[model samples]
Target: MDIGYILSGFAVGFLVGITGVGGGSLMTPLLVFLFGFKPIVAVGTDLLFAALTKTGGVWVHHGKHKSVDWKVVGLMATGSLPVSAVTIYIIKHLMSVGKEITGLITFALGIALILTACALLVRSLLLRKHEREVESSSISTGRFQGTTQIALTIATGAILGALVTLSSVGAGALGTIAILLLYPKMSTLKVVGTDLAHAIPLTAIAGIGHWSLGHVDFGLLGSLLIGSLPGIWIGSHLSARIPEKILRPILATLLLLIGLKFVLA
Candidate 1:
């Protein structure tokens, strides 16, 4: 048990729990761009880290009966699982070109980060708008059900699957936004819980695929997990104490800086 790695994991995990952002979105870029991890190794390790962290979230959500929308989860998994497999296959095959492949992966990751940032920005605005509308409305609504909504959800899932495999970005804030947009009638809490539930399996399949390709770094994964578990526990406990009005802006700023760094790197 490397104390340092454990601490780092704890920190990342805490952020994930507090913010409901996918660890991969933050952890992968942090590992590669800041910590000098190889791009593939960073991606692989982060996938596993994401899987491990989300596992706990899934369990808690399930135990409380608040972690899922089975229909939505099934739809997402239907599209994502195969896409993840295909994306991994492409990466593995492309790596035959060696260093060039790594460069490509890094570029993809950068683009994904930028996209994720944009998604987060859009989500914030939409949620604000939704909040305003709800306040003005005399009644609360139930889940959205329509052809357009279903189609959009499936499309969003497909996009997330592709992006997650390429850059490990879309599964967090991005996925949540898609859900919010497609199912505006649902409460925020339910959306977040359901999204996390779906992400667990989606990430697990993708992470295992990466592992099979010999891309994952077990030592790095171990370190991240050690740190993230406790970090998440503390973050979850403190979530109510923090003000979203303050936290949202800070998180948005962080995302902007990170996105810019990746683009520039």
Candidate 2:
């Protein structure tokens, strides 16, 4: 029943609704810096939070647009799921060795936040560049094919799997960017849908793994969900009125500063 945590979740959800940024990029840091939660707990809680919140998006994408590419999702899952399990095993071993793992988690979280910030800043530019390339090349209907593209897509998923498991960030924004780059011909809707589809399982498994390690805080997770669900609904309704061009840079800058703080700490 912490009102502060509820409000924090609302704010993060509101921003995410408008910007389409992932909650982990915002919530994990908030839990650590604002609430003084351990990095491992914050990350674990946020992973389940992310998985639950994003579940709605998957159904929306599937029912309305059918934009999700199952093949790509399957390919990514092939790489991500095994790595996620392996990451959990490694973390458990580290903990058993009486090694300090919070520092590692904090470092990974910081790095992920910085990467997400850069992704947000450059997303529009990258899309524009992609459009230009498409126009110049007259390429239409870009789809994933060939052994190299398949390998790269799987590799991207593996990287994201490890990154998300460690930091509870990256499965959203970073995943989208990697998929967009790999499948340049995909529509934005498809890219988002595919990424989100992949993220559900990734976050769920990672969250469960963290829960098994006793890193997740259910009370905190409940408080966050209480506010975030409504906040996301309201924010999505209001998103059309916001100027994304102005908002993204400011958010990116905020993330950059926060990332530096965590990295330095």
User: What's the TM-score of every candidate structure?
Assistant: 0.88, 0.94
RMSD of 1: 3.7
Candidate 2, position 38, lDDT: 94
lDDT of 2 by residue, 153-262 (tens): 88998999999999999998899898777878777777888899999999999999999999999999999999999889988888899998889899889888888888
lDDT string for model 1 (115-190, tens) is: 7767767777887787522212111332455665566667778878877887766787878887776667666666
The most accurate candidate by lDDT is 2
Report every candidate's CA lDDT.
Answer: 0.73, 0.88
Worst 10 residues of 2 by lDDT: 132-141
Residue 65 of candidate 2: its Cα lDDT? 80
Residue 194 shift from truth in candidate 2, angstroms: 0.7
